[model samples]
Target chain A: MDMTTPLVEMREISIAFGGIKAVDHASVDLHAGEVVGLLGHNGAGKSTLIKILSGAYRADAGEIRIAGEPVAISSPRDAKRHGIETIYQTLALADNVDAAANIFLGRELLTAWGTLDDSAMEAETRKVMGRLNPHFRRFKEPVKALSGGQRQSVAIARAIYFNARVLIMDEPTAALGPAETKQVADLILELKKQGIGIFLISHDLHDVFDLADRVSVMKNGKVVGSAHVRDVTQDEVLGMIISGKCPPGAVAGPGALRS
Target chain B: MTESVPAPATPSQDAKSFADHLRAIEFDARMIGMIAALAVIWLGFNWLSGGAFLTPRNLWNLSVQTASVAVMACGMVLVIVTRNIDLSVGSMLGFVGMVTGLVQAQLLPGLLGFEHPATWLLSILAAVALGGLIGLFQGALIAYLAIPSFIVTLGGLLVWRGGAWWVTQGQTIAPMDSRFRPLGGGIEGAIGTSASWAIGLVICALIVAGIAFARRRRKRYGFALRPLWAEIVLAALACGTVVGAVAIANSYALPAGVARRLVEAKGGTWPEGGLTIGHGLAVPVLLALAVGVAMSFLARRLRFGRYVFSIGGNPEAAQLSGVNTRKVLMLVYGLMGMLVGIAACISTARLNAATNSAGQLDELYVIAAAVIGGTSLAGGVGTIAGAMLGALVMQSLQSGMVLIGVDTPLQNIVVGIVLVLAVWLDGLYRKRLG
Candidate 1:
């Protein structure tokens, strides 16, 4: 694959739920070591679009290319196998199990005797949590007992531990405090420095302005436009999100408002 | 924005209550509470029965009676943990028992000759396979077809019970194969004095070694360890219980007539004081314990067990995590069916007969045992050992009431009351913890 080939690409993805188009003819791409912010209102199909990429939902009509090679992602396991990871908006941690178990839910460590190597999992979890949240000490307690930020760290740790090439974080900072959100931003920069691509879904325009390399705005199940972060102001992205108006700096999509 | 990140504030740990101290030691309060409740029931029943309830003979009989329910209850823990129920277990047991009886009494006699060694094994395998298939069918409907488990298993309850009657045309099959009869636990089914003591000592050693191994593992990982005194105390308590049980089993002497017959058959005359033969441990009880251990291992150490709990906790999350939840659900039901099959074998062997009504209402007891043992109907929480103890508690209540000449209807009434009370107490405990 060439350097110009995007690390992840979704072309003309569409899905309908109960005859309503949740995501309609939308396309997005993320380059290696780049952060692409997905901005949209509550019902604007951003999450639905990302969910398709993460293999939580199969697109009705789409082509997903990884490093210029087309691939099929029919389930979450398929997504993980292709070096993709997602931190869902709901965090998606099993509340009854400890942090170590949640972190290694599908990919558990096993002993030579074919039993769960719980201590080994716990040791690894401690190493990850130490970097992600230093104050975290409840390794033995279930995730249900954790605070929102601590739970968010568990979800984040799960995503980053596997050396994911493409990370899709849906509202990563929604459940976190300001300090935790800042920590997430720093972590994202660190990951980008390591050449990992990120698709950041966020409502906070400031978050997009501060961290994203480029922004893609979706409105009413369609991508309004895409632009380099430095080329367009937050107001321009907001106009694209709220109305289907494409700014001069953005490349207009089929959903862009006609003048 | 500051580059340096501030440390998150820690929760206060100023005043530690007794419960906090217990938590520090990682003490399982629910397990201890169940044990205490069991003890109270035993002592209370013993007192009410004029000390007869705690005697070796009664206790031995109680253990044998509890074996079948305990076996099924182990599977029920997994079923309930995954937020599903198998109301057809009892009917399934009856159906499987009838089939096993037919195989051993009629079919096996012809194929393997009258007393062939393979007769018992083949019969049991057939029973288990049949039960598993039935369970899978119900599970498929619930998991793949999207039918609610309650409705599927409720349908199963009626269908399987009718199927059981259809198998024998409402007739009872009698006189199981001699080898198979040992599974039901009569004088022939007892392990006898020396073997019971040997097993008891081995279990004690295992208890001590398990604790030591765990401590060493925790130390290696730099995880917090329970106080050394607490560890020793716990080990001692567990070992004591095992040794005490062995002694009680050894104390339950066989009847003089049976002992005299054995001596005479051995070409020796009975002495003035007849020889004592201790009914050390029943075969069915051993089977139950083995099942308990295996189930506990599965729940705590296997990936399948983890997925079951994760699914129970949050099905959507488990699915998103790449767990094949439908397959897991199907297997869980299949496992439950297999346990019911084994339980059916035990019940049929013990009675030396299989009737359509053999295991009627047993589902209620099995579910009760799991629930009383602290398995949440809300799912994601339970233990095999706890359910086994719960079975023992239920058996004690029933046997004690019988010994005291309580009416059968009143016995059911008392059991119903206890089930509700146990669940209420468990709920209160969870609420307090929250």
Candidate 2:
């Protein structure tokens, strides 16, 4: 239960549907204050593996440990209870509601009269966005009216607002511009400094190289390799993803990182 | 530890503020268009019919007539906003009205040997609850069983209308409890003429206060505010309508014959120097207002309402956010059911009877009203106030046609054409906005 133990230790995770393994024997560990980037091509089981830990899907085979204690995350509520939050690629926001409402969705702050304490939510949203994007100002407008980058700010704010220790962000900057992407990169670094463990899923190698301390590549429902960023090149990770074979020159490859 | 400083630059802030103002003006224009349409209908009919349409008596009658449909439209706004429909509402109304008739006129009176006001109140409650139950059942089937709401409610349309007929063997049930007459706009159910004027002024004042409060709140958050001219224009139009309608109503007194009967029945002197006016606001109108307020609160202020819009906008997103789609759906239908029950009770009470064909094809009218009020068929956009206006628009057309001696068949054709035109105009507006 101390900081020395891995914040999340997901081992040998496997999920199958109709006898087809979507994610097979996937293992990744995150420390108390580190960013681990999970990379793969489309349909490479990258999402399925993280979904098991986020409690959006179940793993037919695997064990998940938090602070060295095994835990079952049967639903999103369960995952939230364990302070594991996911920001899906779609952003998963109700477009008709304002940013404040979206950030506090499913976990609204109530007033003394028992209605939604919108002012409190708005104030907190202001604080979060002020840190993440100083130029963001559309608090009352629905998220649909906000730009893609601003919407990302809301989703990111929601994930971090509830004291999430382990964050799973899938393509957090996919729809963002270069400036917005840099803002998100900065936010990720800020989260890292706060001692949160983040499983960053992205197709952007540049982002992974810049933000992630450790990179894990997946191919065909299995991990290709896990290597520290300083020890391996982006092409080495790409080779593992495309060929399902670890680059021989990598510090941590299939044999060393396999569960 | 430092709080983020508000940007002090003016150029971008002013430009952004102006953009917000422009958007607000667009919204105000839409609302103003609705009011203008209402005026066109009112003045057109008034001019064509020699001012009869604009008379207070006719306006008062119109208000009560629009009450029931408007109340239901408030609920329908939610159902449609959730990307769902309830085609069974008309039949549900007939069925509930029939049951209510039995409870008030026969069942309770027969069982208890005498009807108390409390007993009548209980009957109304029972009828409303029955509506909720029926709605819940249909909603569960649609939400949990995964049947489409359109299909489920369409099936309910047949089942419930059939059930209504079976309840009384196709005979028209009559002689609703005397206490129920007020609910149908009877004299006893009305607010007096002076009180009506007072309420009318209060409502106008409330609208002004509400606008000011919202402006202050938005400003406090640094959001854009509408320009002063747009706000002034909208408020003036709204206040003028309210005050004008009440002034017209205050001008009308009871007809001489009705007044004589009232004088005879109450053994009271007819006031000198002025015509004795009838009661002002009807009970049904009050009921509809309550429904409107409560429904708007549910649709706008409550978490349940926010979820309804969210579910309508993106069901997958809502579900992924952990909203219980099935439960919210069920509750929405249940709320619609309760409103339908109130409508049923009003119609039966007004008519003093429930016929087998009571509320027949009323669903077409109700749905048409909701759509005309800007409840998008595509969902995720609507307002209770808009729906209320829609109901008023429909009722106005029907009443005006009847007054002008238009053929019933021709009236139907005209109304149908207007519904299509309204929707088409909505689409055009949406395109222009884009």
* Top candidate when judged by TM-score against the true structure: 1
- Give every collision pair in model 2: none
Weakest 10 consecutive residues of candidate 2 chain B by summed lDDT:
B1-10
lDDT of 1 by residue, A1-259 (tens): 1359899999999999999998999999999999999999998999999988888999999899999999999999999999999999999999999999999999999999989999999999999988988878888888898888888999999999999999999999987778889989999999999999999999999999999999999998999999999899888888998888999999998789999
After superposition, the stretches of candidate 2 with alpha carbons farther than 4 Å from their true spots are A1-3, A247-259, B1-27, B201-243, B261-267, B270-275
Query: Which portions of model 1 show Cα errors greater than 4 Å?
Result: A1-3, B1-15
- Among these predictions, the greatest DockQ belongs to 1
Q: Per-residue lDDT of B1-434 in model 2, one digit per residue for the tens?
A: 11222565656765665434556575645566787899999999999998889877788889889988988899899999999999999999999999988887788887776666666686689779999999999999999999999999999999999999999898888877878767877555676678878889898999899888777876776656788787888789789977776676566676676766767778877666545765667789879988998888877777888789888877877776667788999999999999998998788877878776888888888899899998888878888889998999999999998888899999999999999999999889867754
lDDT of 2 by residue, A1-259 (tens): 1348898999999899899888888888999779999988898889998888988888898899998999998777788889999999999888877888888777777767666667677888989878777777778677887777778888888899899999999999898878778778888898899999999999999999999998888877877778888877877787777776666655443323343
Worst 10 residues of 1 chain A by lDDT: A1-10
DockQ, candidate no. 1: 0.51
Candidate 2 docking classification: acceptable
Model 1: CAPRI class: medium
Report the lDDT tens digits of candidate 1 across residue range B1-434: 12222333335556667787889888888988998998898899888889999899999999999999999999999999999998999999999999999999999898879978988888889888988898888989988998999999999999989999999899999888988998999998898899999999999999999999999998999988999999999999999989988899889998999888878999999999668989898999999999999999999999999999999988988999999999999999999999998999999999999999988999999999999988999999999999999999899899999998899999999999999999999999999997
